[model samples]
Target: MSVATAHVDIVAPAVPGAAPGTVVGAAEVLDRSNRRLGRVPLRAEISTPVEIPHEEQCLVHGWSPYLSVQPIVVTGGRTQQALLSARPANGKGSGGEESRRAANGWIRLWGREPDGQWTVRDPSDMATGGATAVSTPMGSPAILQIGGGRRRPVCTLVPEGSLFTLQPTEHRPQGPVEVRPVADSGFTLLESLRLGEWGWATVVERVWWDEPGVRGTPLFDLAVAYLACRRGNLERAGQWRQVAGNRHEDGPAWIDVLAVDAWLARRRGEWRDLASALARLADAGGTPLVAEGLDLLTAELARPPLEPRAPHPGEALRSVLTPYLRASLPSSLTSFTAAHPGVPQPRPPKRARPSESLPFRVERDTSATRIQWRVLSGPPVDSGAYAPVADRTLLPREPGLIISELGELSEWLIVEDEDPMVLWRLSRTLLDEGVATGVSIVPGRNAVAVALPGLQVRPAAALLADLLGQGRVRRLGLSVGGLRQELSVPDAAEAERILAVLLREGHRSSP
Candidate 1:
């Protein structure tokens, strides 16, 4: 029997120099007999509709220009082939050379079996009638349908906050239907789609009760937490789990939940928990995506250590996990690390011996007000040694607090502030004390990343008479679990003087 297929038109706008029409290019889906089923339209502002070509079959794409494997819907014990025909937007409707180059695109195809084998083929080009076909048996794992450029990864299938309606299905007339994809302004469509692709079983359950304007269902919460975990926001992920309650009525099974919890434990350097989690997931049945994640993680754990390249553990995990799943794991890893502004650096491993390396590395909390730190890497084992590995401790600092790294070698004090007066006051504070060697104002973060190169020295309170006035010195305090030292500006008059200095000295300071 021929496999059933659906027509999904993945359309995009003429980004720069393509046709000047409502749609750009599209993917026309067909069954083994070349019969049409249905189509999923793509665009910048709208969503690729959640159209199940057949029961148990789903058409999914990452939060990107590239569509992922289309889970073939099989019934009545039959297997067949599915075909994807790429149709690029025709003619230079109205654009220039630069515009045309901006609009140029390419396409590719991939196939997956129930046993988890995937095969990929690079089509020569994407022209009308240039179709990429795959054989899908009734029980095959997946058949991918993708469309995008070789270089481009991000493509908008749905804008954040868009609305969706489930309508009615034959089996359940009183379906738990409502407007969908949910208004998650905090995350992008690719992000959510990645969650869908990676959390397949979880996503299936999510649609069961997902409705417009609804928030924090167990399934949806787990997906969001998984996204946060992928982004290295372990603390945030934990909080989301709390919001959704650790357990829910129809949430993931205990084993699947253990999979996520164990992954978090691994990030915190808990190897035993990771092994235990993987063991449980292996014994459990029915959660393929979680199993896939576990398999990817297990391989990485078992593989021999590579040469030191200063790659974070998170980065290593991302590299291992991205091939099997379709969401933008690379970008999430990038955005979750210090490579991207505001991405919190994981707390440094605890140190057994003091080193001359930087005393602290800083990252922001969810509110973006306070700074957080883990211990900086321990002293180098040798000049030619691999990356510094901090002491693997069982306990880690809570990332939400204002942790401070004060000690005898606390020569540097980093002050991140936007006010020019604050910067000027801070520079004077560091310079007059002769404690800091350099003061740099980070442009993007609008905060100062100070370098205190001198020996242990604390600025005297009297030095700030001009700024502190008669308010007298309050007790100096360290917060964020001692990651930051707080200096309060007490008097209104003193605060005014600092604010007044901003217009004149703001640009004078290095920014």
Candidate 2:
């Protein structure tokens, strides 16, 4: 019989009902068959919090629950101590007020530089937390800052549950070579369908945008600045803000970017810098909503602070700044918007032209409990022969809604485009609607990969062919049972020539 320690990542619960910050010794005991036994209490000699690397288990004995059952003790690497104690299913835990006040699932990352500073990224405060209201380090877990922009010249840490990793692997030859996932080098994308939309964005951007020569989009820089400032890295934040300012002169989105920079400066108490950023921001175009948001910030800035009577004095200032920092233009400042009112508005920008719908097939082996999706470049199969295993009605029909009934393993919704902007738009649309689970947008290439579970294959392929076929999606690939096909892309005519030859030779080509 074999026994193994019950393991968990940084966020797993230790004691089923143990209170947060309350010290408890726990060890799992097993019988000869290695089943049907409960935990046995141990001596509370080690006082470390019940977190990763400290907690203990007794599945085989002499193993820390935090470190799984690994025998070797690894130390002296950059150690980050995060508070990941388990909260009760009802959101309550031990230590009463202490447990309630303790930051659960929040991680404190440490870099090799060994600074004593701790930066916080709280979601409730937009002014400090940036767009996502969560603080992320300037580097590490290298996937966050995608698009081959300039590397952040500082150490950073990846989140515990992050789907992407910086660990190095075999390289690929492409537009921009994949960099090592070192603290100094940038991050690369590993194929993942499990990460949420945010994870996809980070990985896609890293692979597509964070290139050595590629300058990031203005919005991307603004986001970086927000994260940098929140982590008390004013130098890094200022650098990113400068990059953004250099990329834009005037526009509503630009105004919001400048406003965020000004807000960060204000938070850092750099009054002179704040004034300069606001001056630049005021020069940018503003709508009625923008004016109102700015007015709120100015009003709050002019108001006096509560005389320590308020439970949280910072809350008042945060309330005003949050809206201003979050405000952004719906669309980018365009030539049409900048054109004179008397003059005719310039023609709308052209979009991608629709291409041939990539042919695909879906098959399921119920006995094996597996499914397969194949993108075909051959003759199309008759629809009458195919039937969906899952009911189509169970899936969401709304433009932005996602359908997921299958378990946690993510299903994919793959798109092939040569334009990053198109991929970004589609990704943002799906993400905003909570449909996109994972995304892979390679920069300088017109290809995208995303994961969305709960979609029936037949309808999903049809739906994509309809919506994306209208000049949005060029090719599509949806995977099931780990089956996938790769396209050897060339010029259109060249690709057709190759395809014709392959078809003549009886090759089952990929999309």
Structural RMSD, model 1: 27.2
Give the number of the best model, judged by TM-score: 1
True-structure lDDT of candidate 1: 0.32
Lowest summed lDDT window (length 10), candidate 1: 125-134
Q: Residue 337 in model 1: shift from native, Å?
A: 23
- The TM-score of predicted model 1 comes to 0.24
- The superposed Cα distance between candidate 1 and the true structure at residue 271, in angstroms, equals 4.9
Task: Please list the C-alpha lDDT of all candidates, in the order they appear.
Answer: 0.32, 0.30
Give candidate 2 misplaced runs (Cα > 4 Å). 1-210, 227-233, 242-244, 250-253, 279-511
lDDT of 2 at 435: 51
